[model samples]
Target: MNALVWYVIMKWMPKGSSCVDFVTQRSLYEVRKRPSKSYSWVAFMLANICAELPWNTLMSVFIFFGWYYPIGLYHNAEPTGAVTERGALLFLLIWSFVMFTSTFTHMIIASVDVAENGGNIATLQFSLTILFCGVLVSPSKLPGFWIFMYRVSPFTYLVDAMLSVSLANALAFCSSVEVSVFDPPSGQTCGQYLSACTSIAGGSLSDVNATSQCEFCAIMDTNAFLSQVNSYYDHRWRNFGLMWAYVAFNVCAALFPYWFGRVPKSAKKN
Candidate 1:
């Protein structure tokens, strides 16, 4: 639930407000005029990108405090005595997420002739990321052909890292209703019957000596649950690094369309 909330918030946060409003508005007048007069498109793009950095950084700090503690994800690190380490990691990931959102919004908006068109494209792209980011649907459950989408989505790494940091190593105790009850074979104890399966799949067996009413908690720990969704605790930092690669990609990509298509050829000749 925390991961889902994070994903939804990050994905929709830029949608509710314009991240590149400053840049896009400049595109309407200042970007074209400056490029034609003395500035190169690259210069304009660089300035615009740099100009937004401080604000985005500030926003990330606000978002981290507002969302992280309220969601109670800090508890995940509490039991493991990794509160400081995990907290710092989560803050960095949230900061990266904010930077990605801003840069991605800038890229899409700059890549088009019309802001409306860019917005529509961005919406479509965001929707695809949401569908394939291993939240609404597990990557394991996605069909072979659509699996690439899961791999390509930036949200994939972001979500995986966030979930691992927030949920990994924690124990999951099933409520009475969540525990499964079944009978073991005629001569076997519950542990003897299900030991092989639990050894491989992970679960806790109750009443090891009983043949009837064998209880099991299918989700033993956060690690086991994360594995089922194709995420792992060990890969948390790796995924965080990967997510920044996407952010850098977005930052670079934001310059392309505006430079090639939006910039006037006459401006280049100047």
Candidate 2:
């Protein structure tokens, strides 16, 4: 659901299209006017980066409020009593996500003359990121040759950090349908029969003394489930940091294309 939201919003991010138009028309006009001859291309690029910050930050706040509490993800934070910490982390992550999206869109569009061309390229890349970000498919299950996509996709870190902080340490109570029922050995109680397995595998048994009915939940905790998907609570913060790294990469990447492709030949010679 989050990925879908990201895709929809980012696909039409206005910064890229607006920047394309500004560079082609307004900025060029500025460069042509005699009085604006001293205009700085660097300032134009920096302005774009800074100007999007407040809007994206506000957008992220609204998204966090709408998406976080209504889904009852707050309850997941209760197990460890880190509600405030977890909530703040999630908000920051969402903010970073918005910032990254804007910058990434600019990065893709900066070198293109037409907005539609840039949109097509952005769509293709975003599709690949969503596909390999470990949401649709587990990282462990990815083909060996394509595994690099999972590593390179910024969505991988965002999803990992979000899911790890949101779901880690929460306990799972298996419903009747979710539980596996079996009989203990004739000579032993259910607790005794399954103690070794539970100790190693980590699950709670409903009845210890029951001779015939042994109920088991294979997923003992949220952390255990996360492990199956190759995400860990210990790495959530690291992933958060990596996401900002990608944002930085996007900003730098956008600047490079604009400098090379959009800057005047006279400016380049200088």
Candidate No. with top TM-score: 2
Window of ten residues with lowest summed lDDT in model 2: 7-16
**Colliding residue pairs in candidate 2:** none
Please give, for residues 113-178, the per-residue lDDT of candidate 2 as tens digits. Answer: 777777778778877888898888887899999999999998888888888877888886788899
lDDT (Cα, tens digit) per residue for candidate 1, span 71-177: 78888888889988998898898888877777777778775656566677777887787778888888778899999999899888888888888888888888999
Q: Estimated TM-score per prediction?
A: 0.84, 0.88
- Kindly provide the TM-score of model 1 when superposed on the true structure, using C-alpha atoms: 0.84
- Candidate 1 at residue 107, lDDT? 79
For model 2, the superposed segments whose C-alpha errors exceed 4 Å read: 1-35, 266-270
Residue 140 error, candidate 2, Å: 2.0
